[model samples]
Target: MKAVAIQSFGSPSGLAVIDLPVPAPADGQVLIATEAIGVGGVDVLIRSGALADYGFAEGHIPGSEVAGTVTAVGDGVDTSWIGRRVWAFTGVGGGYVEQAVAPVDEVLPLPAGLSAVDAVTLGSSGVVAHFALAHAHFAPGESVLVRGAAGSIGVTTVQLAARGGAGAVAVTTSSAERGDRLRKLGATHVLDRSGEGDADAPPGYDVIVDIVAGADLPSFFARLNPNGRMVAVGMVGGPPPADFGMTMMAAFRKSMSFATFSADTVPVSDRRAVRAGQFAAAGRGELEMVVHELLPLDQAVSAHRKMDAGEVFGRIVLTP
Candidate 1:
């Protein structure tokens, strides 16, 4: 089998494809013939050695999510899963390959009407947004804001909030064209990074999904309604919000809350439910799974380059 491994740490050039023996599934695992692999920000961090605590040494394979077909099952697994189309969380890495093995527990049958590419591209983002929104406890008719709204997770969060009956959906994007696109996809308003909404509301947002945590965070946090909360899910804005303490103190009178979300904190059963629901919503045409680019597995380096340059508006998928 062929797999792309981190030839070394640092740049996209570090990624190189190499031939490796097919991995045999162990107990409670299944081998998937890879079809598509999703690229994530964490993968980029790992490649650059910025996330050392979560990374492996050179020559490591890096992929956490994949969509493909089960070719074989390991001990304690059902044979019925064989030949079944599925997408899975491949532990931490090992997905930038032709064949990847994932735990049976992490594998979900690809629901009808969702393509393998769509699932692979949107799966992780959907799951993350679902949980983040749940943690924020957003309600119908409440106003919501999503930072980096043009990104994959932001797009999903925006649509899901709309589906949940949010009265207002504000997204932050630098491009006016992208903002217009998001408006068609259910965003009630799109603002530039300077925090200008299409319209003003003094009462402010009830829930904020912030992917960009920077100096601008405090201003957004200040916009939350009384007793409302903000979830910092990504760090695209370069740094953790400066004056975070001052920001919290400013919102203290209203009892506003601030927290971060990690998919690891979500239970497997709940994750399964979110994944299934997202798949269904997408199948019904309620949620759009955006694929900004699709490249062959061997073009992994080029894909990484695009992501690093922030040129990707949605998920970038690699097909094997």
Candidate 2:
């Protein structure tokens, strides 16, 4: 099997494609012929050696989201899953290869109406979006803000929020062009990150999905309604502000609580449920997984380059 591995952690160029022996599934696991692998920002961070503490070491096969067909099953696993099309979160690595093995319990059947490409792109992002919306405890007619609303997770979050009955979904995009795309994804209003649109923006939103954490923290918190919740998902903007203390103090006064979605912390059963629900939503046309581009497995380096440049509007997927 051919796999993309980080030979060194520095640049996208550091990722090298090499042939490796195919891995066999262990007991309770199943081997999948990977049809699509989803690229993520965490892959970029790992490739760049920025997330070393997260245990992404050199030579690590770096991908978690995959969609494929079950080719074989290991001992103690049900044979029924063989030949079934599925999508899953690998939890660690092995997604960037022609063949990967995953615990049978972690895999979910792809909905009838979803494609492998869309399923892979929705991998973890869609699961997190679903979990985030659930955590917000939103009700019909509530308004919400989605930061980084044009990116993969942002796009899914917008769709899920709207489908869950948000009356108004305000999405923040760094560029006017991206804002237009967000609007098409169901955002009732798209706010430019340039601060020009801040004057007349709604004072308080029922929930704020903060994907771009750093600088946007202040403005995001300020826009939250009393007792509102903020789910921090990404740090695209930069590191959290040094004055996070003050920000938390403000949130404290307003009775607002901050929440974060950590895939590692989510129980396997819960994660599986969320992934299944997301796929069902996609099948029903109530949620969408935006696929910005699809590249062959050999172009994995180029895919990482595009992501690092912030040039992709949605998920970049690689087909094996």
Candidate 3:
């Protein structure tokens, strides 16, 4: 198997393609012949050793989403899954390779109207957007602010918020080109880079689907309307540096709520259901799967570089 591995914790230049022997599936696992891989900021973070809290070791293969066909299955897995087109998590982070073994429970059948690439592109992202919006209890006519709205999960979050009848959909991104593209995708207002305070919302937002939790987070919290909810999904900006406690106290007077969420918190069955729904939505063209770039597996280094530079407008998929 050919996999992209980080030889050291530093820049995208450290990502190297190396050959490894494919492993057999353990009990309850299945072997997939990878077709497409989803590249994102988390992969760059793990490659740079910024997310050491996750215990990613040196030479770790960083990948979370893979869309492919099930070539084989292990004991306790049904034989019927063999030869099925699917997308799944590699359990840990081995989806960067041409072949990966993932737990059967984590994989799902590819829907009829969706391609393998679209499946992996929207698979985890669509599921997370659904779960997060559900957690925030987003309602019609509510105002929404999507932090980091140019990325994969952020794109889906923005689409869902707008389609759900949000009276206003505000987004933050570094590129004007991407911001304009986001407007066509449903963003009512686009702020450059500084997603928090740049846009004016005199009444504040009813729900904030925040993917970037940086020093600007306090500004977002303070922008929430009475009884508004802010769900932090990703910390692409590292961590919050300001005194959030003071802001939280002030927001408390307005009955605002704040929380952090991860798709892993959802039960496996529920996760599967949400993912399937997202896949079907994409198939129906009700949701947009913005595939910005498709690169060969060996270009993993360049892919990470683009993500770190914040130049890519949408999801980047890798073909193995």
Candidate 4:
């Protein structure tokens, strides 16, 4: 098997491809012959050492989701899983390889017509977006603003909010071109990167799904309407300031609230159900799958560079 590993942790160039013996699935696990791998924001964080405190070290594989065919099943697993097309979660690492192993509970059969690329792109992101909307108690006909809505999770959020009957779906993107792309995905309004103060929404948004949490996060909280809820899911721009809670308190009079959400808190069965439903929706064309680009497995370094540079507008899939 060929795997990409982090030789060092500061730059994308640190990722190196090397030959390794194929790994066997452990009890309750299945081995997959990966056909597509999803390059996500977390992969960049792991490569840049931003997640070092979380135990990501040199030699880490740096990928979480992949889709392919199951070739082998370990004890306690159903033999029928073998020869089936499926999407698998390889924990925090071990997915940037030709072959990977995942727990049976972490694997899901692909919808009848879903391609490997689409499966990997929507596998985990769709679940996060769905759970985030549920967490914030988003209501139909409510207005939604997806801060930094260019990545996979952000893209999924925009589409889901629209399909769920949001009266207005606004997105903050880097340029008009990207905003135009998002508009096609059901975004009703496109605002500049500093979207919190956009003139289009003087009344404020009812819900905000923030994927970029940085020094500028406090500004977005000020744009929330009465009873508005904001969920922070990713901090790709960096962590918020220490006094960010003060900003939330300042808006307390309006009954606005802010929270950080992680899909890990959702029950495994619930997450799986949502994932399967999303996959079916995508297969039926009720949802869109945004894949920015596809690259060969050995180009893992280049893929991370593009993601770190903010050049990728959607999920990047790597073919093995």
Clashes per candidate (backbone, < 3 Å): 0, 0, 0, 0
lDDT of 2 by residue, 190-242 (tens): 78763336555676788888887876577667777888888888876666777
Clashing pairs in 2: none
Worst 10 residues of 1 by lDDT: 194-203
Give RMSD (Å) of candidate 4 vs. truth: 1.2
RMSD of each: 1.8, 1.9, 1.7, 1.2
Give candidate 1 regions above 4 Å deviation: 200-203, 239-243
TM-scores of the models, in the given order?
A: 0.94, 0.93, 0.95, 0.98
lDDT of 4 by residue, 190-264 (tens): 898888435675458999999999999999888799999999999999899999989888767899988899988
List the candidate 2 regions with Cα displacement exceeding 4 Å.
194-200, 250-252
Cand. 2 Cα-lDDT: 0.83
Answer with 3 or 4, whichever has the higher lDDT.
4
Error of 1 at 240 (Å): 0.6
TM-score of 4: 0.98
Model 3, span 46-138: residue lDDT tens: 888888777888889989989898998999999999999999987558889999899899999998979888987798888888899999999
**How big is the positional error of residue 264 in model 3, measured in Å on the Cα after superposition?**
0.7
TM-score of 1: 0.94
After best superposition, candidate 2 residue 117: deviation in angstroms? 0.4
Candidate 4, residue 73: CA error in Å? 0.9
